[model samples]
Target: MATKHEILSEIDTNFPEYLTFLQTFIRAASPSPPGDTTEAASIVFDFLSSHGISAETIAPQPHMPNIVTDFDGGDRSGPRVVLNGHIDTYPVGNPDEWKHGGPYSGYNDGLQIHGRGGVDMKAGTAASTIAYILLKKRAQKLKGSVALTVASDEETGGKWGTRYLLEQGGKASPWRGDCVINGEPGGLQSIRFGEKGTLRLTFTIRTKGANGAYTQLSRGANIIAAQLIQRLLEIESMTPHLSEELRKHFDSSEVRLVANEIMGPGTAEILLAPTINIGTIRGGFKVNVIPEECVFEADVRLPIGLLAEEVMDHVYSILKDFPEASVSKQEAPSNPANYCSIDHPFAKHIADTTEHITGRRPVQLAGLGGTDCKFYRYLGIPAYVIGPSPRSMGASGEAVDIAEFKALIKIHTLAIWDYLGSNA
Candidate 1:
């Protein structure tokens, strides 16, 4: 039997090959909103198949393929660990805006891998893929199996990706696992146990139809939309009740210090409040036109312990001030907040592995952004996220530190072994 130290050393020896795989993945473009992940999925499928790991590509929609594979251990009585990663990335707005290189350049400058998805996911995805491959080589020494789901369409929302794979009503859904470890960037110093829920609502203000020339008689929809935006901004100041567990952690000086180091200042306050962002507004057809209908979309992220209905009630209260504005819950895309206990055995194992590998204990924190991990939590499976720090996740010069990337791979590899290898 190979010791954990030996396995880590093996990873160190093959670190260059892993970097190549990451770079190759970054080179393949799979941006959302026209998210065609066939090229990227092929890269993953080919790599896994060539390494003697069986994988299949499943696509509910054309041009968007998800790769699923597993390694069966000799013993079937132990826990099953699922390693997941999203292949699609945020779209690159303009190539000229990138300071390092093009979004798909996959540029490496000795200390970082520079690309659009390098930090946001491709680095983490590559790490998961490499870890599965490494573990398969030692499958005979394990007690449980390991599964991989390289999903697509996570950025815009995972309706067609992880959500479909897990809830598509089939025994062969390929999402069977006792716990899931998602490779989404959460910084090396923290492991995300929960994430805030998302609720996107578009408010449409309708007025009596009028021609562009008749400004005096028309009740301008654009004016109403502007007033709604002002009122929606007030939700930021309203704080919600935090869970007892979260409040306890927030009161800790050590946790606050760690959170400040990882996420910025006032991290505790942000986690306890529902954040609202006015995403888009479309109203007038021309400068002089008073449109009959004006629509504006707002994205509301509910914190843990706050229900969507409660937030919607609060929103309704605000909307009462403007009778012209209304919301249709059926048209809104919403999901309640989900979380796993920080004291969960699997979460503890990940933190322990991080401490063992890097000499620093990871802080337990709630993720500000949504991820496919939420879907697993919805399925009653505990999911945790740990990856390299995202320096420029959705920005132009996105990249991941080479050192952090290497450390992430070691941490994940060791943690998976510790979890699936032990009978407890």
Candidate 2:
């Protein structure tokens, strides 16, 4: 097994180069709304190839591609660990909101690396690349294997990314593994053992249009859309029906403290609760004439103990009141909220390894947001998350601390070393 000091020293020597690698990756910019990762995927594929590493590109949809690198150790019987990270990030909604050369600018000031995807994930994906390189170099001495899956569709629920990899049998499930370690930003204060689920509903309301003066004949579709938005808020009041174990997990003082510190005040209490957001509301063609049609979308995220069906039930009950507004579409890509026990071997390995390197043992808690992790967890595989803090994750000024970025590489690399080299 490799010593912790040896790993740290090795990474430190080439740390500057690794930072540059991350900066280059961020500059490529993979945004998911338009969902084209060809430019970003090319960077990852080329970087690995330049290192004399072999990787394959799999794209169910030509626009969104996945880069997968797989290599086994001397003893293939040992547990296989999958390192997952998504290159695609939330679309930069408004370029003007970004101050430091816009979202794609991978700016570095010696302390932090700034970009839209850096905090959300590109930094971690870059770290995964470096770790994979280091692990592949020592494959002959190691036990099982390390597979790197840099996904492209996590921002919109992965129809063509991680989920597709799991579904592929042509490759004989090379991407499936004994455990998965994802680099979704969990703020490094906690090892996210689980995450909430999402249920997106698009409501469409239509009505016959009339001039503003003829309001008495028929109400505008916008009127009903506004009412539906208020009704969606009721889902927030739906309490979580969690098992005792999950309830106790969040109730722990240490877990609550970590959750609060990582996200914000009062986050712990709502870690397993529903959150409703009317993300998009488009209605009224013009200001003067009554609108003929209105379409609005609501994102209702369900906590671990709760099911999407229960939330849908509540939504249906509310929709019954407003027959004018109906669900035009629903995003069923969401999996049920899933988790691995905190004491699971892979989860413990990550926590212990991180504590060894960072001097602080990360608490175990369920994340408030979603990640590619749920795809693994839903398959009865243990998936753990550890990465840099999510500072301005989906908004402007997104960034990751340079030191934290370096720490992530070290921890992920050594943790796999510790696990694959272990008897357990």
Residue-level lDDT tens digits of model 1 in 143-249: 88899999998887777888889987765565758888877988888899888888888799988667778878776888888888888877777666776767888
Count of clashing pairs, candidate 2 = 1
Model 2 per-residue lDDT at 28: 90
Once fitted onto the true fold, the runs of candidate 2 whose alpha carbons sit more than 4 angstroms away are 97-100, 207-209, 213-216, 422-424
| Per-residue lDDT over 222-265 for candidate 2, one digit per residue giving the tens place of the 0 to 100 score | 98788778778888888988778778878989888888888989
lDDT of each: 0.83, 0.85
Off by over 4 Å in 1: 99-101, 169-174, 209-219, 237-241, 330-333, 422-424
Among all windows of ten consecutive residues in candidate 1, which has the lowest summed lDDT? Answer: 327-336
Model 1: lDDT of residue 125: 86
Clashes of each: 0, 1
Clash total of candidate 1: 0
